[model samples]
Target chain A: MQEKDIFNLLTDEGFCNYCLKTNADDVEYWENWLEEHPSERENIESQKNLIILLANETAAQVTQSEYQKLQRRIQLSKKNNRKIFPLIMRWAVAASLIISLSFGYYFYHKAQNNRQIATTISNKTAPGSTKAILILANGQKIELSAAANGTIATQSNTAIRKTNDGRIIYDGDSKSLLYNTTITPRGGKFDLTLADGTKVTLDAASSIKYPVSFTGKERKVEITGQVYFEVAHNAAKPFRVLTRGQTIEVLGTHFNINAYDDEPTIKTTLLEGKVSVNYLGINALLKPGEQASVKSGVSDIRVKAVDTELVIAWKNGLFRFSKTGLRSVMRQISRWYDMEIIYPETLKNTDLFEGSTPRSANVQSILRKLEVTGHVKFKVDGNKIIILNK
Target chain B: MKKGLDYINEWDAFVQAENEAAFHELYCHYFKYLSFIALKKGFPVNKVKDNINDLFLCLWEKKGQLNNVVNFHNYIVSSFLRKLYRKENLEIDESMFVETVPGLQTYPSVESQYIAQHTQDDLSRILKIFVEKLPDKQKQMIYQKFYLGLSYKEISETNSISINTVYNTIYKALEKLKIEIGKENLSAFSLALALLSLLCLIYFQKIS
Candidate 1:
């Protein structure tokens, strides 16, 4: 084969494809044929050299600066990657913190309003239910549950009267005074009148221990859970309420205490007269229609103006929900209608609703209204309401 | 066998550590011959140096992960060629290399072809400087075809250019390099060396 022939053979499209595509068998055949052609060997040799050279030529050089820059970029990217998780975690924590804080604050204010309403309504009607342990000053224990509904017993100096309103009142002609303690339980509410004629309304899941009769420098009560007070005027003896984590000192004032153990914060609302609230080592004197809150272990006390009717709505036999979530609404429902709440996962994301319903309204009616407004559905199974997805 | 594995592991650890001295030693040991092969394939000098530097850096990054690299010289040469072809955006069908050379009437047996063996050290400082001078595009094309061993079709596909254009540009670049390097009275060995070095340099410069 001439040089021209060899070049053409190497460069021919068909031959190139065959060589590139075929196996060792085909390559061997070509190798044998080329080996047999000794006369045109040099030409074949040069063509082979050119082919080899083409194959060998492949790599390109890079500049020092460019290489250094790429290395730097890769390193920087790796470093940045490490910070991503912490940054995301911080944002998540911050967002949840804000959300929980807002929710807690809103509920605190709302509960105060509910307590106010509950007090006003509770004073007007017969108390719904109560579990109060009556302790006479002489250390005699009378379980209120076992005693008759009215006028259980009387001390020699004081008249221990149980009114139709579920209050244990002491009506004394003289200035005789005696002390007693009434402790209420979960799913229980009660009313009482002190010897000084101070009216007290206790909410469900609550307790209050006070004097049966008054003839002292100060009228004081120790309480838990929730209660509304209408203290009789006593210029000398100031009325004081001691609860978990705080104290409320009043002078001829009407107020409420919400110190439920499950509750994250303690609340005190002043309805009328002067009262000083002390919480988390901080003290604030409150006028009527003012509420104070202490959250967690923090001493940050927040006082704000409030509507008195909304705060005391619960005592009025009305279920009031103000910007309340599904969980909170269900909790209230579970208590009132005496039902178990089972919520589906999807219902957890439901929007908050604010409204009021009479306690006389059945469970189904409240659920139906909620379904209409929030686009959620519920199934009533016996005493259990299963909240479902829309 | 365990001792061999341990040695390999140690070597990998050293590479991962980015010991510049070890890389420089490896360069000195193999770059000259590698540069020669690159130049013969028609890469410019600067490109050859750049390609070598990139390879070393890559090797360092993937130190412990390196495998199937029995012949470091051939591996580098092949790797360089592949990078060049990719850089130029060439789409050479790999199957073609196994096929016969196009436009040839007769071909020599593959065994008889004088494919120069490249060493790591052959790629040195002088070759790097030489490649730096070439135009960017020319350097890239030369590296793609020669160093990367990509076919014109692969180059075209990668670079988003016509196959015909890849061929013509490579042809033009080789011719220009041959003329430029021919002026020096370098030994035939160094001439071949210069050719490879220059091809890599020119190709890299062009692409960059």
Candidate 2:
């Protein structure tokens, strides 16, 4: 056999398979054939050498940035883990507070102790609500009522429609030109519409500034709080949302933007269509079912696969909690119920939750359901929800 | 407590309890060669770094539970390849959404069958790199044979190439590779090569 023939046989799956199976006769035959081809000996040696070279290459090295990121993630994970204990302790304290206040109220009323009754009433009163200021582009302050509902304004020929559904919509001509801003308190939720007919549902303690009409080449909006957007289709005019340190630009898509000022990262989740997420100097093109998060001053964006429904469950009128902590859960409750959350430091540390409740349901009902799960217990007196040890 | 100690210890633990420093030393010593392999395999610089980091992390995480890993470098290479495959699969899933969502309008499931773990050892990486550098026809032939693990008959059928040409190209590729690495330590090189060849044989034999 020629050197080429031997090489071919070595590369062939059948020959390799035969060799692997330890077919003595085939090996003998190949060896004999190679012995007879003296001219091809050099070529055979080279083939052997090449095989060795191919086998010796090592694994790739990790980059410094990746190492740093991993280190940071480890640190953050540790920090989060540490915080879990404190949150639990806080829950314990809150539970004690609830018990004392309830007993005090009962004793004071039963004894007709007027002085004690006043002090106990003051102690049991709900914590202060989150105060938010809405600064309109026209320099006007709208002190939004906790019970405010319906259309707030008409700008740039578009109606700034706020629905009872806790959403805002901009319904008007695509050519109309006006912009408005809406701000929400920590314990509040609001909805808005964009000029180009995009519906935005802002989570508690969030704010957004958007024009009444998308008259320019692109529909752009600035956001500060968490907002879910169902963008209207206009391929000619791409929709762009700027939040904190990241920018998401999409051409007719559905997505959610969570750029809360206090959060360490700006997360953009693409529900449908293509979006280019620009953060930390990197432009990552994202598709549906993908989420990208950018940290402040970090040039790298972390991309991960996620379920879109889980991210936008708030807009769907369901408080779909997935592996969230008690503090996060309370934060969401405080917004919708418009109540303050005060707890001992330890209660803040516990972070496992998975439940769903209708947004329209009263706070007491929601807490009762949570109690059934045995993961959490709550005491409700009027608008305040006291976290209890489960 | 040190910057590189954790990684070194992890690597040492993979080989033997006290040998983690050796693993770290090897990792740092051969960083360039490993990077070359990653680059040749089409991994961007950033991703290559991540791949290696993940490999070290995995080693550390699985240290106490690991069995004897034959040929540590080959094992690392295989792990890296699997990471690259996973990353690529994710990208493909993401791209599928973009292509089919609006204009194409096909509700293709984002899931792919290629999500399975693939461990192509060091030899395979070297072979892939060499084959990629070959001329179009040569590269295709090598890919069909080695990468695709095709038989001579299959290669002949796929590209209408004579069995003789298939053999010749494989011979030439092996010879070129041997010459390139011949300058290094001969005995250690030979052992590594032989081990790799055996590994490839076992891998493809199972697949085929």
Candidate 3:
């Protein structure tokens, strides 16, 4: 390489590759190349250094705000092993561990303590079941959960039936398209397959209204409460989900929409493919492993990379929460158990719980886990729970 | 109570054990440097802040691997910056706003020496002078190449110039830079190299 052309070579692909450190082979080649051609070394060296300086200059100034945010994210991500029990309970668990320590040992102690107090003696309500009410286009209400598997109903030309696994599947293509609404009560949850092969799992107290046969360029579904969608891709057709204050559009993707009316924010977490979350006038796109949170009374949309596992834990039958407040945790419990929650009048506690238990666990078992926190106690009376100070 | 080196030494152990207190101290110690580096990588202010947390999360996930990690501070700095860049690229999602980068080249390996004596404020001050001294065309080329992390091909097409011309433009800018900064202060370029390695570290992380 000529002296003048050294700069050109440096700015070229190979030189950039070297700086970016593509491989050991590239680095070795450049080192030997420089040694062999020492005449152009000085000029090449200077240009190389300049590239480094320029790269350094790319980063802008940092702010205190930035540091604080980083700290919060780190804390959020480190929650895998967080028990979140109160300090007193934590010490008790620690002492037990010192005496008989295995991961299962501590869990065994908890299971025994919860069973002794919760499931056997306490008024117990089981978690939600595979139950839903199907409203036909003609306003006929069919209790799908009570009916045996096989052909439950035929909407237009589509056979609306339950699989062996109890999931509703729309098997046949319906030429005459009519809308059907499936609703799950407070103590129920159900999964259904749409005409376009889209699979939706509706949570308790949620409903989805969709057409028996999808037509036109867009497949539209209106939903309330929480639902998980595995949208079947139709390149020419798009899938749009409408909720209270937001609309999510996707070509074909796996996503979870938590738009429960009780929650302030409508969170749409994408697990695969792409989804566009449109709220108010703004549009925020999401990739796999990213979540778009649309808040009430706010037009601005916030996007963040999140643990997809944590977001979809409900669908997987786990009550996975991170630093969740007692109030919110109890809210979820109420929906799952078809129970009402009442708190003491003189509430002065601010402690939040930060752990998860099986959703299928009895109400007493669930409450016992919270009680172990040593912050709040639960009195399960019939289908109502009274929360009080410890 | 451990300051500087003492904190750095215990960082891995504290993180491994999920010791929030010890980790909080470490976060405060390195927060400023990491924040500055993220900004330099062309992240928006909100994202710069978010990436700081993402970096820690990424660190927490790989806490067990910290036992094998050498050059801890450099690893943290480069990874922190890289985390910001990766989040933007990887999480473009379904938003219609982002134009996906075609074949984005990753930055080099994060070597320990990447961040050195100069603070964020110091680096910014010097770079501002250098940018001010350069001509408009040279400044644009430098901005496109360095700040944007654009390839020569992309820069060429974006600017509607020949590929060689893109090289020449950057070369001329560097010549001007060496002349203006002088041979005596040549060590500054090496300092920049250390910083640039943060990008490289991110790039390597992407492939691996």
Candidate 4:
């Protein structure tokens, strides 16, 4: 580079601005210019120092009154220019609804013929009711459904209560830790509140054994069959649920565990917070709306996202099935209706049901809904349901 | 420095949503920087405040046209400078300027010299002594560029001189530093290289 060109650059207004780092464009231009003129870098840099030496004084201050005055002017200017119109949106909504209703009435009858089917059964099997046998640590049984709403028993200083809505509550602290087991038999479901204030809802044919008062560093409970729990939040004393094949550790979260003995895999579904599901040597962390399943005697714990509403439908008094096999649906029914489902050798377990019905419906109505699909028929012989493929 | 995304969103809210809150944020962000520039450019402190208001008011009026501005900081700084320089016949006394760099008044304590060794202050300290010996006009121009954070175009307009003259004066001042530092057994090449690195550091952290 010539000395005159170097001198020209040193005196250039944009170059001086670039050196002081004021104008973004000048800075970008000089940087690119420097990159291309590698040989002239030293000369160009000596000049940059002169300009850089003068940059960045602490900025002058703006008073509060100055700020408020400018803000008010900006606000007033915005209000003067803005013109609002809300009527167009309302008109658009009304017109779209009228168009939808006219199309709906035209096709209403055509769709009705194929949708409705009627069936009646002479023998009806009522759905599961709120009933459980609570056994105290000292070999005493108290029928929960038959027991009146009040404090039924006191263990160590804690009062065991039965709410009018069929929920058993264990209130107050106990000096000595004692364990109580609540078993929901076939054709029955129950709700229980542990001494730690954790709420447990046992599905049909499920059982939970918990301490009358949680002590030590953790609150631990053992469960069998399907159970939904809203564990009380206690960060210091972590809540742990022990199933047949898995141990779930949580610090206050809503989760459901399906660990029924008849099922091949133990599934733990987390609704909120975090829960760690550990089965044998395999460990899985479950986020909300995620299910962790581990098969018996298996080392791999599979984690997948599942619709939680369908998983906890039983607790909400509904039987929801989506691509669920015949065997799986019957197992849930068997627990609810106390009926044994016998699938013959010729029957295909592959028949999947995709529908939901109220759990309060009679067993025959639930079966009729499945039979209407024309894949299978049920022959009810007292408490036994013999499944025959159509 | 505030991120680019925050400025972009504030601009969008101010223009599209017509949010007064976003307008207030943008007004405050540039108020100090612009006010400093206006005052350095020879606008009296009282007039600098109102001049800043007029500049922002003009910006708000033309906000629709400014929606597609790519570099918001450059656009704002240039616009404010342009507004201040619209009139060509402002009287500014070049000799009346005082040399007071806001943050450069450190008395080199024993601990500071130890800590600032091979640091920015240490490198700048070598040039600071040389800079102070420069003639009043040259020293004030360099101070406006470095200490006061003004562009060469701003310094030219501030002194009512041509941009070329502003460059020539600064060029002469730098040549003087190169010769003076060379006499001190510090090669101009090495000192300039060190200064170049410091300039890049300042370049990246430029908030205005």
Model 2, DockQ value?
0.03
Report the lDDT tens digits of candidate 3 across residue range A200-261.
Answer: 99999999999998966689999999999999999798999999869999999999999999
Q: Give each model's whole-structure lDDT.
A: 0.59, 0.57, 0.68, 0.71
Interface RMSD of the candidates, in order: 21.9, 17.0, 14.5, 23.3
For lDDT, the strongest prediction is 4
User: What is the lDDT for A353 in model 3?
Assistant: 48
Model 1 stretches with alpha carbons more than 4 Å out: A1-150, A164-166, A173-179, A337-347, A379-386, B1-208
Residues B86-171 of candidate 2 have per-residue lDDT tens digits of 76652111100000011110111121111111222444454455544656555545433432234555566545567666666665
- Tell me the tens digit of each residue's lDDT in model 1 across A130-153: 556778878988777567766677
lDDT of 4 by residue, A208-297 (tens): 999999977899999999999999999999999998867999999999999999998999999999999998877788999999988888
List, residue by residue over B16-108, the lDDT tens digit for candidate 4.
777777877777656755655465546644466677787788777877777786556545654555455555443221111111112221222
Q: Identify the CAPRI category of the predicted complex in candidate 2.
A: incorrect
lDDT of 3 by residue, B1-208 (tens): 2323456646855756767677666665555444333433334544655666766667767776777654465456545534554555542111110011112232221431253232354444566677766665666566556544566566666556777786677666655554554533545554434333333332332333
Task: Return the TM-score for candidate 4, rounded to 2 decimals.
Answer: 0.45
* Model 4 residue pairs with clashes: A11-B167, A54-B145, A54-B146, A54-B147, A55-B146
Model 2 RMSD, rounded to 1 decimal = 24.5
Total clashing residue pairs per candidate? 121, 36, 19, 5
User: What's the candidate order when arranged by decreasing DockQ?
Assistant: 3, 4, 1, 2
Interface RMSD of 3: 14.5
Q: What TM-score quantifies how close candidate 2 is to the native fold?
A: 0.40
Q: Give the local distance difference test score of model 4.
A: 0.71
Report DockQ per prediction, comma-separated. 0.04, 0.03, 0.07, 0.07
Between prediction 2 and prediction 4, the one with superior lDDT is 4
Return the TM-score for candidate 3, rounded to 2 decimals. 0.48
Candidate 3 stretches greater than 4 Å from native: A1-124, B1-208
Candidate 1 interface CA RMSD, Å: 21.9
